[model samples]
Target: MAGLRVDFGLLLEPLGFIKVLEWIFSIFVFATCGSFQGETTLVVSCKGVVNKTVTAAFAYPFRLNTVAFSAPDPEGCGGAWTDIYLVGNFSSSAQFFVTLAVLVFLYCIAALGVYIGYKHVYQQNSKFPLTDLAITVITAFLWMVGTFAWAKALANIKMATGASMIPGIETCKAPGITCRLASVTSMKTLNVSVVFGLLNMILWAGNIWFIYKDTNLFNKSNIISQSPAMYSARRI
Candidate 1:
């Protein structure tokens, strides 16, 4: 059997290099959003008790309404306190964003393999380039939609878990009781994910032109441009 030939030089080309970038950005998008775990603290001070801390932990998918934390011990607080829950249901948007990133990552890996190993076959077959162009366009659109939705969801998450949550807590309304947010997890990485998402969107959208150039339509257009008679006839 003949050995499989690999073209390392393709890695230097626009198609291969951009696919590598897409693969890397996809990893960032998923890792930052999928493996994340965080918590917010509510510090409660009562008339006769030391400040009691209540912590609500949440993670990826961000179904804030489903996450609840126990209130400070009622005996210590000198009044009954109910459990507290974070607000909002943002799982749909978060899940959609993460799932799309993962799919894009897989596609990039497969595309790079084809570029390196079977580039000759891909070039000779017009169908391959046409299919690639179609997929690239769809993926670009998905990145735009998913990234925007996820960004909006992230903002809502910040509001639900931050100081804005204090007013909604019943315990904070009692006389002589004061409640404030002590801390919340930093979303710096998630912010970076959004940035990467935007970059991926732009990269994929730009790549569409390059892929289009590989298709028969681009060649036909070029041929027509080179022949003024053909171009004039076509315009007629």
Candidate 2:
């Protein structure tokens, strides 16, 4: 039988509090992309006293929109009003999809870890069950998987948007309206949230599993007194 050498000096109190907070944070980030939804200007052109503006709106008030505008250069409008056109719009679905996948994975694992922690702490059963250990291990595995997915997503976005510069797209003339696309490939704020939240969740799951496995062994050894001696023990 495996047993934890309990040190009366060591406190096991509030075993599940940190996990609960991590779970809540992960869920909030997964469900909301509030910062990503807004109007963003991508490209601009200035020529022949003309200026053009391109804007991209994301997760907007429903139905993303991109608009282009061309106006005579404020300084000097002449020579056929060199009209310059700019183009910009919400990033491709591929970008958003990858992000969403990572967020979902983190959310699920964090929530599970928090729940398990709460159960283990409140119940305070000397012999934690195998089911509890299994749950913790599974959640930890998921956090690892989420981390890999997040890396892939970041790589894909970098390749697709490449420093926010449009590939093969030529710059617009100062006076003419030339179309250019702006890249909205990454959300730095959300990325931080995902990374930190996953790290905390994964660690929490590992801790629970470590404790649970030891407890299970103790139970098997009959070291834990689950019931009162009068009812559960046989007198020799």
**Residue 164's lDDT in candidate 2:** 42
User: Which stretches of model 1 miss by more than 4 angstroms?
Assistant: 1-4, 74-79, 229-236
lDDT, residue 214, model 1: 88
- How many backbone clashes are present in model 1? 0
Listed in order, each prediction's TM-score against the native is 0.91, 0.49
Locate the minimum summed-lDDT window of 10 residues in model 1: 1-10
| lDDT leader | 1
Candidate 2 residue spans exceeding 4 A from truth: 1-14, 31-35, 38-40, 46-49, 59-128, 158-163, 170-186, 210-215, 218-236
lDDT of 2 by residue, 1-236 (tens): 23333232212333344444545555554444334443334454445422344543444212222332233245423443332222333244324433543554565464444344344442355434455455566656655565555445545433334334344334343335344555454567546645654664566565674446446565655654655564655653
lDDT of model 1 at position 156:
92
| Leading candidate by TM-score | 1
Each prediction's whole-model lDDT (CA) = 0.88, 0.45
lDDT computed for candidate 1: 0.88
Local accuracy of candidate 1 as per-residue lDDT tens digits, 140-169: 999999999999999999999999888987
